[model samples]
Target chain A: MQVVALSCGNGGKEAQDFIHKVFMPHLQGFLTAEGEDAGVFEARGALALSTDSFVVDPPIFKGGDIGKLCVCGSANDVAMQGAHPEYLSVGFILEEGLEVALLQEILASMQAQLRLGGLKLLSLDTKVVPKGCVDQIFINTTALGPVLYPHLSAKNLKEGQVIIVSGAIGTHGAVLFSQRAEIQLDTPLVSDCQQLYPLLEPVFQSGCKLHALRDATRGGLASVLHEWAQSSGVGIEVEEDCIPILEGVRGVCEILGLEPFMLANEGVCVLCVEAKDARQVCALLQEGGAKKACVIGEVVAGRGVTLKTPWGSKRPLDILEGELLPRIC
Target chain B: MQVVALSCGNGGKEAQDFIHKVFMPHLQGFLTAEGEDAGVFEARGALALSTDSFVVDPPIFKGGDIGKLCVCGSANDVAMQGAHPEYLSVGFILEEGLEVALLQEILASMQAQLRLGGLKLLSLDTKVVPKGCVDQIFINTTALGPVLYPHLSAKNLKEGQVIIVSGAIGTHGAVLFSQRAEIQLDTPLVSDCQQLYPLLEPVFQSGCKLHALRDATRGGLASVLHEWAQSSGVGIEVEEDCIPILEGVRGVCEILGLEPFMLANEGVCVLCVEAKDARQVCALLQEGGAKKACVIGEVVAGRGVTLKTPWGSKRPLDILEGELLPRIC
Candidate 1:
């Protein structure tokens, strides 16, 4: 038989690369999602679970890949259901002739990041395809865990509330583009990709009325914000200056003719809160490890999301089409 | 771009066959796994899950593939942990210029069988590839479902319990050859590919002190049996004749230079039993959906599985070596 170049799937080098380059740096705290022989996950009380598969290509980028993206992606889904991320079972589908060393690197990175994010991976399964038959690799991460707020739901996004962001936007997208093109930035750019459990804990424990919490993934903040606005049947308003943006990232965006507002940010989140305590809630979030936290926007009387520009002019923000950086992960 | 020629991945058919006739029959359930609008999967419970892939052509023959073998090949995997097969998600990776109708027929046939087994199908995802990249269409099915017995745990298997199986031996392998070429047989060959759960409920409810239950897939019964023997640190003995085998399947196995004992069975199981309650427990399983159920084996004083033959000879059943039917599903 012809030994066409191919890579073995499951816990190999390419998968491992996916972990370190995109997933590890963005997360923090204890418990590992990447390193152990197996992940230790549990839910003593009632649990909520979700699993997702990422076939997004160029497997690794500055922000994330099918690997880490698969992790946070599943975790976030559970969190939306008011459940904390606990255990995750990862399954891999790799094309043959893949880089083994790259796979090991990704695993090491996943192990480290999961540990930092304080997640325990419960189980793992893998499969390999012949080269040319698959798009490098695909990841299916299934999660299991107990619900934090028993009756809490994403449906809790009340009409009268404020919206907040934990950190800056577009850093992940910018870093990924710069890295992929091998286009060096004047100042090195790194993705802002991260896990949210650590920061959310304080909010959850503080008993603050967390009306809504969501991480801007595809379609960025614009799409999710629009979705919330439509679902809540209320309008949202945000000041351009209030949103955080790193200088280095802004330079890359300008050079590439990209808009930060439309770019993806894996580790960033948007939280809606009650009107009365919005400021106080924002302060608590910033103090509780949300280094770049700020009141990015607010819930208004009308429907849809609007942006207040530097000149005080307003325009509706829209979800840009296609990927900002195809497979920016 | 130049188009490439492709043979029907499913048991080669003439190029002039009707499109729907080739692929439609392969569609399995209500939500077809083939020819659909990007598989629509509904979530009844959070745990709806499914899995399917092709082990056809060179992947079969040596061991298993397509048709008769695919049933237990993937479905039993879901059953191992006791998850009820609810919805199956199917996908096809076809070589370029492939016959669309050919692929459709395979899906239709699968859907019919799944419907027969009461398996719901959620959606289908499909992709096209240029020829030489892949041999033929590789169908991958993913199933979804709510856990039937959330409390069904392997922990129920005790040290002193017995094990049992529903029906006859390897019919899957026999059918593959019977369909491939003309062969001498006492009668028509058949494959015993059926869901194990239909016959499992009564056993679970009856209090047969079952120590563990494992559905044999990849390596066959001996492999899984050996897993129990070593993991549970128990011994097992089975009388050859007590294990059922259809006459036609046995005849085909004898002529094709194959071993029915070692080949895979889509609908069968080998059980371990305690010395005291073997017959009573077997009777319970037989009365349940498993009318042909039999006590094929027992846990012995020593470790490992021993096969007792009519000639008073005993031998060890082992796992397969290397690749048994390269892509046998």
Candidate 2:
């Protein structure tokens, strides 16, 4: 958010000047999108559709917004399902009389993230209501992605796809949880809130064998693994020691008496791919700076997940251990 | 609604049993649909997707519930765009401690309405919070329809298309308004809340040549007409006398001192097609019991809607009309 000329407040030449000089540089490549009631773009690949509403209070968090998160969050879902994200439709439910510049800033953040992830927004809609009615601005983003690879959906989870964790988890949950806390683990940990498409392009380019994918957000990988198990009716076996827990993320969880299994991780996913292609997929993941990529588990023909401890002890995994970091404001 | 060994408790298997017995009969075509986590179906054509939230007050109204309306509202939006409605996704945001029986009834209503509309609900997600959190269940429905015909979005209107009203307007608004009145109209008005797909299927199949389609829902024909004109960059002209308004509907609106133009109408539309095709469309619509189908006006190559009065005077159509309908209740 850089301050330029203040002359853009006027309706005619100044407004157009502001649009061309400051905004157009950022808003280009959106065909005929510069001057229109709504932005429209044709989709290019297999249409993967997902809608998410970002009504999180506090306009800005430690690492992101309800706006930028709104875009990246929905995009990751599309990518997790193995679709090349293309078009996004944004609906803004704005509290009345929000500063126009603030709205533009959020839109700018959203567009910047979309560009970073190599996706184009297809359409946008804005609705205004009285200020008391809502908590600032809430956005509902619905995206359409083309499926360049059809076998990426969770439905294709085979009897055996090696499960890989992208990186250390619980960053998002821990950051959100320790907002006003005295327990400082270092430079207070923040969400790993970022896009995953940059992380995915290389793997797709490498033609690595893959079966299914999912992002562990609202419910962590534990919940996700459980869903995958139930959907595929395949059991999962994992060594508990293989999972990486960052020091800060782990410390906060320990202090709060919260299980990391149920904490959200916005920037990572659990990919179920063929064991044979696990090395190549890890190499591709390295390009995205994910050094913690590890094949943590294997799929078997059973019902649920079971954890194998270092002492050769086993315990059943409760897949629905969801959102242990409850109501973090 | 049946006397089949019933109690109003929404707990246990009673709710699921009621849903299966009463609602499953309405949706017989699903192959893997016997109490599945989500409805799984093949995408057969071009898809038109829509989502709407049903927060209508009274919970139960003259024709439906938040459950019934949620399905119908989303399904109707797809129908308005001339799409063959197929799949629906239902997500409920329920307040905890709410009667389980009430939930069961709502879910039953939802399933029944989906069956009645010949739609398979592809997904259902239920989230709960402690009591007093949620007032009533707020249902968000997302419906998908395959566009077998060309997309008849509001953005496609041309200058010569005739504006056709599908039926007597304001019936839904009147029914809702009269629910609180001491004095009612001689003819008690029930909401015209029925599936628009039954009416749309023939039009999509008959090839009657439609260019633009819109539902006279919340904001009515005036709001939709205004939207169409703005989207297509064309002007709409409507004759006051040609428009159909039911006697009881108008009476209730007059007594309530409300502007019927901006009120909600659940089962109505403003269809724009070539003037030559108007008769054919009207004939088909009439056959479907939409007798009030009238050619209210035509389009001109300017933007905005102008309403012509019986005395030959014209006024600009503005959606900013002020009226408090307490619609959410």
Winning candidate number (lDDT): 2
- Looking at model 1 chain A, which ten-residue stretch has the lowest summed lDDT? A1-10
Q: Write the per-residue lDDT of candidate 2 for residues B1-329, one digit (tens) a residue.
A: 42322221121133345445644554434323333222334444456666555546557777776777877877887776666667665555455445656666776777677778878655443434334433455566667666656656667788888999888887887777677444344456778877788887777788788887777876577777876787788999988889888888788778777666666788888888888988989989999889888799999877789999899999987663433443331
Q: Which residue segments of model 1 deviate by more than 4 Å?
A: A1-46, A63-67, A150-159, A181-187, A323-329, B1-163, B169-195, B245-270, B309-311, B326-329
Model 2 residue B26 CA deviation (Å) reads 10
Please provide, for model 1 over B1-329, each residue's C-alpha lDDT reduced to its tens digit, 9 standing for 90 to 100. Answer: 12323322211112112224443445432643232112222334434233445535432343333533444444554554445555454445556675545444455456556765576544433334345545665555444344443433333334446556666666665665555434434445555666665566565556655545555444456655665666556776777877777777777777777656655566666555454757776787687666777777766767777888989899886544433322324
List, residue by residue over A11-105, the lDDT tens digit for candidate 1: 22343344444334433233332332222222245555554455444567655555677677666656654567776656555566667555655
Which DockQ-derived CAPRI band holds candidate 2?
Answer: incorrect
What local distance difference test score does each model get?
0.57, 0.65
Task: List each candidate's DockQ score.
Answer: 0.10, 0.09
Judge candidate 1 against the unseen true structure and give its global Cα lDDT, from 0 to 1: 0.57
Question: Which candidate ranks first by DockQ, i.e. highest?
Answer: 1
Q: How many steric overlaps does candidate 2 have?
A: 9
